[model samples]
Target: MQNLQEGERALTAAVAAAGRTRLWSHPELGLHAFVDAAGSVRLGTSDRNWAALVPLVEATATGHGRLWSGERFVETAIGDRLAYRGHETVEDGGRERTTIRLADSVTGLAADVVLETCRGAGFLRARVRLVNEGGTPLRLESVTTLTLGGIAGADDGLGGLTLHWADNDWLAECRWRRTAFRDQVVPLSRSVHGHEGRGCFERCSQGSWSTGRHLPMGALTDRDGRAWLWQIESSAGWRFETGEREGAAYVALFGPDDAHHQWHQTLAPGEEFHTVPAALVRTEAGGLDAAFGELTDYRRDIRREHPDHRTLPVIYNDYMNTLMGDPTTRKLLPLIEAAGAAGAEVFVIDAGWYDDDAQGWWDAVGAWEPARGRFPGGIQEVLDAIRGHGMTPGLWLEPEVVGVRSPLARTLPPEAFFRRGGIRVTEHGRHHLDLRHPAARAHLDSVVDRLAGEWGVGYLKLDYNINIGPGTENGPESPGSGLLGHHRAHLDWMASVLDRHPGLVLENCGSGGLRMDYAQLTVAQLQSTSDQQDLLRYPPIAAAAATAVTPEQAAVWAYPQPGHTLDEIAFTLAGALLGRVHLSGFLDRMNDDQFALVRSALRLYKDIRPEIAGARPFWPLGLPGWDDAWIAQGLRGRHSTFVTVWRRGPADGTSCELTLPHLRGARLQPSVLHPTASDSTAEWDATEAKLTVFLPRPDTAVLLRLR
Candidate 1:
């Protein structure tokens, strides 16, 4: 079995061999497009397997080339460089030729397989083209699978894992049990559920599932309406049952079936089909959020070079109803000043700054104007105020939407709006902008430029409240084209906006958790977890924390109302230990005791900010369940650590014993600090085994520091 590094090398060699045949030069990252050696056509990288495919060709192929027997074939090569193409061809006499073409756009014909080493956790992409060279339309079925090289086992590093999906449910047919060579299998029962408007159907899980064990990730689907994407991190592992079922056609190593799954399309007389699969390895170095952030940086470096990239953290001021209507500048100015004093790196002035009449701000999204009534001195005054407070100011814009009453609706080109005739007009208080159109890009760019250059806005929160329809609205188009226009437009807009703003922070939001996917994460700096911030909703939030690599980049807001005590609020705030923190409560309304508590917690968070931001997170207390309490901790280096614990409902007599891993063999001192009590500290040696701590109910948390 080849290791990741060795696999990458092998793959690179194969691409080089193929490149010689087509005489094509390889393209650099971000700028290159995969092409076919036979016909010299362009092929795009798969969304899932980008890392694996890009590097191999860049290292081997160079120049231009193409390989396609007809329009219905997949052809990809290293942009203008080496070309590697594989496809099936049918002759007039009912004969078929399935071949892999490798040619250098510079040199010419090479070998078959481009075996490159798989560095870190990456993917291997091979373009499959099916052409009707014999003057007839062809019907074909194909699937691409990678055989991993590693010892199969359960304890070899895989266990306690769960798969995530935007919409779907898991089914357990049997408990996980070890098989041969440390391999394990967990049985999955078939289940049906709706996921974000799509029907999901999972076949029974009948394959071995492991965390970092033999298999890191896997997906399986027939050419039907069922598809799956499964991934598990090395830090968290789970067991499952796997075996042949009585009626199933094939056994999948992982994933449940969902109804909303869509299948790859069929190639007509002049059509083509493309497929891609990607895999990544996880580790105990940090939570998923941190890991993802690192990956994003790596991919960015591989693709394009950004000269002035810097990390910027932000806090929202108007989220707590602090800024509504035409409030006196005197009232709002101080809060912004206070937030800046509290070490808030960026200050955002949310909605209501725009009026429906002037600049048509509220009703007119397309017209970028500040309401004169709301901002008597114009947006420049607000910007100057934020700058004076020693903080960067950010503005929120829902550029994708437009209100019906806005003047732009009547003046703008009719094609700008998305509609389905009278039955479905793109009207929902605001209409979504057609990003695919050139005019839309130009308009958005103008607005973004004004905010960045004119107002000196350092950050932009781009929010979208709608989904795009397929290209079917454009007439009789292919299923792929239906969504392609929107996809292309989104990519183009993101690239353009980021290029224009350079170092500006772009936070993506879709009502909240709806857009928490890799595609969006690639372009935006942060994502909102969900709108539900009630203290009781911490369990699901914590669960989601593991799924995404950077929950710290998630927007988590906390506040204390009249009925809730400061201690209760602190307990709730602890749950945010797994991610970034956003506070929305009215600070001025709090009493001295409550204010003091906030100050104390803020101080502690500030002290351990580095650790909480960079270290691997430990959910000592499992996901928050109703009537259940738990603790979450994160440790950085050897001496710094932060802990957060919460007790929901009435206090129970139950005490939780937490066994700390990665801390054994170290000298440590632990202390408990309550809002009403003084801090108590104790010393212990963790050299021999895991350190155990006991917590009584009503929820209490302790911080551990190494001496």
Candidate 2:
């Protein structure tokens, strides 16, 4: 034991060593790294036999390498070794942003590696830019955003390392699966190469929702308890791969893989191509949750500054149960009144507010205007009504598409919409607008300014409901490149809208979470987790959403219907407790008793909502299974932990236990934050480091705080 402790101390010292270059270390997080003069990177969590390796950040031209024989980062082909050019560092909101420049003289390629961090933060973000400085254009086949070479440097083989991959779908989001990195990705090999060889495990997102097929994030944990999580922030194509080769194992992150993406950009002289930003979190203590907890902090650090994320306002949309996009003045009055009474901060009149009541309103939606019949006294009357209740008025706008039958669809030039082969690309009877074009931007800007600026609306729920496949082929670039370009332009446009309305908040929704990516989340104040109304299935999405986004940005609906019992009402409300509560359903029709339950939950949500801004997410019962009878997701704050547990189905899961060893050694006082029911019981079993709960019936939920 003494010898083992001495070895661990030696590894700690070695991990902290500056080696050939000055090492940058996060003082409190125990993360350390250094880049040598040759552009080789050595980093890790400072645990023995568990270090990250990046011997090369290679890029191969058409004629480079052993002609692309599984070679990473153009290592053996360049005539001259990559040399460190210089470095620049800047600070943003207390975080350090460093740009380290490296160049290969023979290849005439300059790589600017950008990294972000803080003194005590447990995470760092990295990306690379490849610039062509040579006399002619070069066709680059493969370029990796980040190549974490030697991810398992000291180990003979990555036999014990585990990879955690997150998967997402339409209603099902943030599903995480943990498997042996070797067995799942790169199979453990009996046939070894020298003393340090390994196989590869790779996963990637092809287009659009990077988490559509699988999330653009993953984590690897070693036997010694060292864990590192890496996530890609792009909404477009992104990839991450883990492999063993030569004498080491590696994890490489990329924006697009040329093999599948058909992406090969020819960089002209003085031209540059930058990869998407990616972040990595490392921890040697408390396992995966600890690493992710720091990642949560890093996620918060990277988000664009906004007050709404801090406020976590409860939104009441006129969609789900009451109106369903067919809101009239009569329908809006009673629902709006109930919403205010239930403690909603923003009352958004969802879809169909603009269309004539007689016409179908699904597709012809570009020209955003209040219908004469729907709003008899104009939209302002409803706005005044909402203000009278002391709540902000918001409206839903699908700014990206124009209805095919709408006048603007024919009036706007073909160049304004996504085009292919000299024609507008129509999907689901709606034409997607190419925001990159000035005309398209002008149209949407006018709509936003009128609603938010003229009408004094404080919030805009931006919705996009169509998928134009890879993208439009009308522009000079490929469809994928065009899509990415439009994505950046759209984000800029959203920022401009925010600038126009200083107090306005934007909600991002793409057919409910199809575009729920970090790129959109950065600018948009919040994300609609799902449109699923099933109270049972929603718990999983709400529980898992924290993995994909911060709890504050995850707008989960706590819709309680008029027919639901008190137990059923609590079950519905619990899903949104730890997230941004997007209250919905037919509250106007609900009885006073049924409505009181919602108001009780809302009061509790408002009380604890502030702490959620600075909280770190955790799955006390692990990532909630889609069909799990009982599920739990929680947030740990500075002085308290808030947990929401749901018992669903007739599975007789009223009696359940939760293990929260995070407060194991501390003296904690536990109490119900929401539900406030006399029958619901949560008793702390300190000896076992668990909290056991018992409810009399199914479809019931409870919110508990342990401080």
Candidate 3:
């Protein structure tokens, strides 16, 4: 026993002699990580002290990581028991990537934490690779892709930290709300309890709809304006939590977990699993505006290259309040001409284009054939009409599902469809397609080839309307793992389609912003921001769309009816000018003046699109409220900054002030770029960096340009 104690002391001395603690810094991203001899990592921004940081890697396996008394994903035995391996850094195309390796001697679990950062960028992209080096299988319940600690206000402790998250729904997407961190994660006296609290403020995806409940993105800001923003890139399932740890705050981001997502994985010897990618952005000051700006840049850097991101073409879709999924040649010919005249570059024939049956087309929709009765001259005639008006032809398709009554549902193998208990899973009269199967992939490939290749379609709006519950049970894998596999395969299939048809623009729509995550947005060219029909209720969504997606990739609807006043028409049109324009409405029947107003908005958008493609989004009045009387959103570029303000209530004569601190001391000019004849006015105060704008009428909106 004495010899054993002496040997343990000698081993501890050897570890200390070998440098028990090491600090790793990524100056470009302002990230500092400290690793102790026990392989516990604490990550923080350079602005925080190393001593305040907590363990970075948190994991919970079947028989490990139960040391702490909490549902929180920290203090895992595997995390604390790991031994730090050497790290390697590599530079590729001006971006630097560093990999830190760690291994647990007890469980034989090895992890490679990979972080990638671009030069001069203020964000870090992170993912983890977990491998089983033991002779036996290891079951994993949860593992964090990225974890950060040591987050506290410069002056106060956790008292100054404010938590911000967005509540997402079908129509009410990106409804950002903020509260004091202490309000959600109440103080637990560690001095009395002698242990961390057992609860955390967590937001997680319920099922297939990643953003069905809340966005996979959030922020923490201090009173002094410093901000830390994070986003988990997963279309399958995700969870993010922030809680008090060791007198400070820590954030843990996970892809999927057993407790919340029914996702667990058993890794055999020599097997490995990779977590979904996540990103973090830290700003010294400026709060969410600055942090989100850096995140936008990072998003642009990581997404697949496509021309639609740069061109920012105006798209006219025959959905929303216009057609309501019922369309025909008689209804489309005039609209095509009118849309082309309104400067639309793409005209998409939305749902019901393939419905030939008297019954609705919702369930019987796998076959994407144009109805002969609706288009007696063939769908090609309308396609040619769109081309005649100098616009590219597009179509809407829901590729991930097959109608219960469709022939493809019977023809596709059972393995190709989502199955549970040896029976096919059906939802809303549709059977979900498991893209991991070759047959399912081939079917979608043939469909895309037929539309984009044979018919020469330039754009495709891939809509997913049904959430197919947990996932398929084809193999001996958890339902969560199955969902993750399908999500990855779906992304790969989209990328393959783009590789084959590089010019084809694909719009990602999941019942309107339900699947709004970076995993899908990084591949698809555009994301449908929402399907809200009421123009009045759309301002908040439009104002906060940038918080969920990049401005260039976010698609907002601008549906102006002919019965509305000029202000109403301009109000709807202005909401879409900052992002990709999805023009709808009865433009064919509108009076000349109303049509001209839409045309003017489109023309102005065309002029400013070059700057928008390179701009970073900022909210002057902070994130919009669901029922706020006033809302404001801005895009800042190199030479110009544009602001869009909407007044929805409080009658007339109401004005709002927007603070743009970045432009405080500049000699500037402010002009109403759209609806140039409206009664709305904008005045700039360089001394205070505030822009006071007034729209004399309610339900009115205006777009302003500052240079």
Candidate 4:
């Protein structure tokens, strides 16, 4: 390894001799990278403070080098021996992409590290492309999409850093945990040991549910309020780790690997593979909220353009706490009428619309046709009724699985389904489809075309319920690599569907938020946040959903029952006002007053949705806790700021104050924007930049506008 002075002199000489250097900096993106003559790269926010840095490409392959290799995914001999080839940049619109190329002389392995950023943005998107140039096959164990180091301050090394990550599961999703960096990665006294630590704090996904265990997002914040927020965009397997390195802190994000997801790849000569994308945002002072806000902007830019994001039509699905998959014509017509009357723009007949057997639809699902026994007059009758009420008709379909007993399971070729050791894979009575196969892709394409094109359905709710363990085995490919291939093929199929029917809307749901990741969100128009039935338990998920998804795409259910009090109805409705409204429950049985309350909330949401499309999210009271008594979330727009505060349990205090540093010392008038007839009151204190909201009763929430 070259010393700092020697590396600088080499860079200067290279630049002066051939107009090339080992240092590359992008002023517009605030990105600084150092690639030594040996092809070793180090990335950070600044250039002057680079020291004892980790390599940009941390990879391990079969018959490769591992210096003190143990559990950590770093310090590989191949990453250190690669020689720098060249780099090029391309500018398109306001975004610029730079590709740094490198290759290993010993193994004939090559890599292209692609980095992209928008002009005037504080974030960077990175991915790697690998090719095998040697005659022999190379089996790769693990590869990093992005690695960033030099995270500590000049005075405080790792003492002032705090680690933040979110825990996700069925119903209980987006529960964040924050701890001191030292707690997870304790001091090892490397000065005396004469070596770096072998362990680090790591989080990874399991099975098919990308977010079943933990969200693919995490952060590190300093005492000075600076933060680095990052997310790995993969619908397959993903892992991220942060630990103390050379007295500082470093984070490495990856997509599937042998140790984590049973994923590996054997590349033949001239074959190439591209890893999933990952992003990182650096905020100098505003902490997590500011970093998330920047990430939100980046998400909006990466998504496929669709009108559904801007319109944000209120969708009423008869599934959660309502029809519960038994959607008959007798049960759906009334609800469709009530939903349309309550201001729903789209009505979805969820789940059991296809069951004809008395046994159940769970294990007999593949055929998406309407059931004659349930619909009697045919499912078209219910869809017609929805359209008559001026709403877009939709149907729920899980296209990735076929019930083990379904006729298609036997008819389709065995290769169309996921298989290992010449046996088909089954999970929860359903067989997973391998979309990479032509027959599987053809079957789904036919189903979607029949519903969205022939039937004139304007929306389709795509749900994935089962976790099919690791993945299918395709010859020499590992299960993890097969899973990655299937996921990418699924994404391509969805994009093709949209290309055929440009006006249609697709809702991404994985037994409600389990498959929540940007790789799916970028293609789908909406994401179901959760399937929690209790209204009190949903505020935390709703408040913190924007950390993983954009505001317009995060769909929250608002199911107000006929038996609830007026306040209870308001509570549920207000939670969905900031996000895409997923209305359910027995609206047909609600009294005139209850129906009017639902209508009024939807009307208010419609009026404010335009601002929401462009607003940046903020946590006035910080990110919400699972059991917090008082939860607050705000969206800062160009013209005004909107805040939603929820108070739960037996409140000891009737009011709580939310600090808004941006509005401090500015003249403002704040007012409650929802439940015009409620006891909720809000007062703005311009002097302190705080909004004190009073909801006299428990389990109540209010949305306030400060301008």
lDDT of 1 at 627: 38
TM for candidate 2 is: 0.90
The weakest ten consecutive residues by lDDT in model 1 span: 254-263
| Candidate 1 runs further than 4 Å off | 1-278, 282-314, 320-331, 357-364, 419-427, 467-472, 478-480, 539-543, 560-564, 591-593, 603-606, 611-614, 621-627, 631-641, 671-707
**Residue lDDT tens for model 2, 1-707:** 01111232343344346444434456664555555434444444342433235433656667665323452332335412555555556665666766666677776888877777885677778888889988888777566666554555226457777778877777777778888766764543435532232325667766555556777788888777677788887776677777654335567777764564545667899998887788888787666777778888887877789989888888999898668888888888888899999999899999888988356877777889889988888889999899888789999999988888888998888888887667788888888888889999999999999998889999888887766666666555556666666777888999999888878999998777767677788888898888787878888889888877888999988778998888888888888889898888889999988998899899988888889999999877878778988888889988789888888877665688899887776666678877876488788877678988776677778888998
What TM-score, to 2 decimals, does candidate 1 have?
Answer: 0.64
The pairs that clash in candidate 4 are none
lDDT of each: 0.42, 0.76, 0.88, 0.89
Candidate 1 displacement at residue 247 in angstroms: 12
TM-scores for the candidates: 0.64, 0.90, 0.96, 0.97
CA-only RMSD, every prediction: 12.4, 5.7, 4.6, 3.5
Clashes of 2: 8
Of the two candidates 1 and 2, the one with more favorable TM-score, higher being better, is 2
lDDT of 4: 0.89
Candidate 3 lDDT tens digits, 367-446: 78889989999999999999999999999999999999999998989899988778899999999999999999999999
Cα-based lDDT at residue 430, candidate 2 = 89
Q: Residue 475 CA error for candidate 1 (Å)? A: 3.6
Q: Give the TM-score of candidate 3.
A: 0.96
Weakest lDDT window of 10 consecutive positions for candidate 4: 1-10
Instruction: Point out where model 4 deviates above 4 Å.
Output: 1-22, 47-51
Across 1-707, the per-residue lDDT of candidate 4 in tens digits comes to 21122344455457446432445565643557776444467887653555556677878898885787667787788777766666766777788787877788988889989998987888899999999998899999899999888788535588889999999999999999999999999999999998878888999999899999999999999988888899999999999999877778889999999898999898899999899999999887888988999999999999999999899999999998998988888888899899999999999989888998778888888978889999888777888899999999999999999998899999999989998777899899999999999999999999999999888999999999999988999776788988999999999999999999999999999988999999999999999899999999999999999898999999999999999999899999888888889999999999999999999999999999999998899999999999999999889988889899999999779999899998999897897888878889988888888788999999998988888
